[model samples]
Target: MLHHRPAHTPVRPTPRRARTALVLAVAAAVAGLAACQAASSPPATTSVTPAKAPADRPDRGARDGEAAGHVPDGATVFDDALPALAHLDPALLAALQAAASDAERDGVTFFVNSAWRSAAYQDQLLREAVAQYGSAAEAARWVASADTSSHVTGDAVDLQQTGGSQWVADHGAAYGLCLVYANEPWHVELRPDAVDEGCPEPYADPSQDPRLQE
Candidate 1:
């Protein structure tokens, strides 16, 4: 004879334990989603150079040794025959290059004997001239004060008088160059109007230029 048995059922977890398990499952799902999103995201871009502060920013309009028409550094002697012209005013240099080309066409080679000089160099020259001449007045005739020197400003160039200055003196006016001082035939400056109107009478010397009187 067989005996009847009641159906056996598994016991469910207690309410507290069931709630805890659901909470853990939800938390694990959320964490997994966050990790997947992170893995799919793009990497951040890192710059090699740090951004400069406003005070450390570079001047956009300035170039090496030339800020607002400041004189450039002298070029090395090994560079070119007219290397000194590298330190001269742009307008003056352009005029000189044109004049030199024209002179060369006529079988003359122009040369720059002197161009820009630093303030320190100009001051040293002034001191040497004063010592050699034994008077500031006599020195002033040859070397202008650094404060007023065209060389310091890169506005003047001295050419070899024998050929370069002689050639330029004859033809430079056509290119806007003019001998600037009556006593210094080798010294020239840009006078744009001279291209068509001719150069004005030169000052007697550096001492006579009003810029040097002070």
Candidate 2:
């Protein structure tokens, strides 16, 4: 005799199980979307502060003269664009031009290293000199006070180039350009009497100059 077999019934999830499954599916989809968003987003940035400059370092940009009268390398005495040259005393400028023209004949060009500084610039230089030399007296030998500095008065120039400076040293008297300090061979000043009486002996240094006393 064949036994009758009961048909298998498909098991249906209970209400609680179905609700739990639906909540799990929704949570998984939200997690996937959050991961995708995180992957596509740019990395977070951090803010950084710049380091402060040293207190002892000279501030070259703070001085008005540096902006208006600073002489770049290869600058000629006739560079009208630079206030260093343009602001020079009329007679001194004329003398320099004359000497520069004569120097060109000998294949030497007058390159100005410094000229016509503002009084504030001169004071800054004096402070720097003091710091470098470790004393006010030593600094005075190199840099004069703003009130006494020929640079501040637009009456002095610092020339560069070995050939050009030497040429000026040799023939400067004819043009009334005189080296005022024995220590500074590159520095020159207009001494109108030098054209007639020849250059007076240079002071041993600016310290010994009577003009500096005043």
TM-score of each: 0.61, 0.72
Model 2 clashing residue pairs (backbone): none
lDDT of 2 by residue, 23-106 (tens): 999999999999999999998999899898899987676445456567877888878568898888989999998999999999
lDDT of 1 by residue, 118-190 (tens): 7877887899999999999998988998899998888988776657788767788899999988899988899
Q: For each candidate, C-alpha RMSD in Å?
A: 11.3, 6.6
Clashes of 1: 0
Which candidate comes out best when scored by lDDT?
2
Note the Cα lDDT for every prediction shown: 0.77, 0.88
Candidate 2 residue runs with Cα over 4 Å from true position: 1-65
Instruction: Name the TM-score of candidate 1.
Output: 0.61
